[model samples]
Target: MANPTFWVAVALFIFIGLLYYYGVPGNVGKQLDSRGKRIADELAEAKRLREDAEKLLKEFEAKRAAAEREAAEIVSNAKEEAERLASEAQEKMADFVKRRTASAEAKIAQAEAQASAEVRAAAVDAAIKASESVLRQEITGNAASSLVSQGLNDVRAKLQ
Candidate 1:
């Protein structure tokens, strides 16, 4: 009963009993539970945010695909238009060339006809002069003049 160790042990037991009576363990347990609940809520919020991000990613991907398709369609239409225009231009050029060639040929034919007429007129004039000179040399006086005139008249009528 007089030992110092025995008195120290008794004091420790009394301190433990006071703490229990005041509900300190219960308060610690409540705080731990609240902390755990807070951690769970934060985890749940993080998962929801991740799900929203994935949804947004999928939506953006879909939009990108649609835009690509539209762009391809535009390019295809442009190519077709360019080809059509090229063909039309070629056709127009061919038509123009044909028309020009035909016009040139017609002009050449007209020039040839005019040249032929001029040459024939010149030859007739030369033949008439030669005949007149020969007839004057071969024939004599009044009878010769009358015969020459008649022959000249006949040649002029026939040639014209």
Candidate 2:
């Protein structure tokens, strides 16, 4: 009635009042709260996933360390076994050499005894031949035969 501008301002205020009276502000607040809650839930899920990943990494590290320790133990056992086998082989070789050396020495001693016995037999045969020759040169037939018998008896008694 007085100014049209004043009427437009009043109509704008009435429109704002109607929006507030119909619960639009409360609906907007509820939507904002739901969005915040959803964001918080997603953040919590992300934290749980990160923690699970860390736990898996630690487990893998522990398994790797155990595997390395087991491998080292296996290598050590193999080395000890190899060393024992080598030591046993050395001992066996030494024993075999000692036995062979003893056997060789016994064989050498037996050969020496056989040679000594043959030499003694040859010397006895030669002495008998020389004694017979001397006896034949000094005596004739019947006297030589009688002296030969007595010398043979004396030689046999002395040898026994």
Candidate 3:
């Protein structure tokens, strides 16, 4: 035992003699108990952290769902607003077209009335000139009588 092993043997003798005099077995048992308690606390802390993480995940999912619902509602509202605006624009356009058409019709009616009045005035003027020519050409009483009959017939036909 005079080799390197002699030193290891000498250290072990010192350790055993110190344990016998100081009740080192009880100290070892106390150290092991404290280590076990520390291990148990670490496991409990790990479990608590896991539960907190799960709760946070649930909260995040709930918030995401709420945001999605809100976004959908907003989109729906926007679509409705767009449709309403489109409908209003279409209605205004239709009304504008109707008004323009009515105005054009009114102008056409006024033009037709003016044309008819002018035609009637021209017809009366022509009839009066023909009567004057006949009176100047025919002087006999019977010729005058035939002229009056023809003039009356022309006026009646024009009136009809």
How many Å off is the CA of 68 in candidate 2?
Answer: 1.6
After TM-score superposition, what is the CA distance of residue 27 in candidate 3 from its true location, in Å? 7.6
Candidates' C-alpha lDDT: 0.92, 0.89, 0.87
Error of 3 at 100 (Å): 1.4
lDDT per residue (tens digit) for residues 68-119 in model 3? 9999999999999999999999999999999999999999999998888778
Per-prediction TM-score:
0.67, 0.61, 0.62
> What is the Cα-based TM-score of model 3?
0.62
Predicted structure with the largest lDDT when compared to the true one = 1
TM-score of 2: 0.61
lDDT of 2 by residue, 1-160 (tens): 6899999999999998998999888889999999999999999999999999999999999999999999999999999999999999999999999999999999999999988878876777678778878878878799788989799678856753
Error of 1 at 128 (Å): 3.2
Error of 3 at 39 (Å): 4.6
Better of 1 and 2 by TM-score: 1
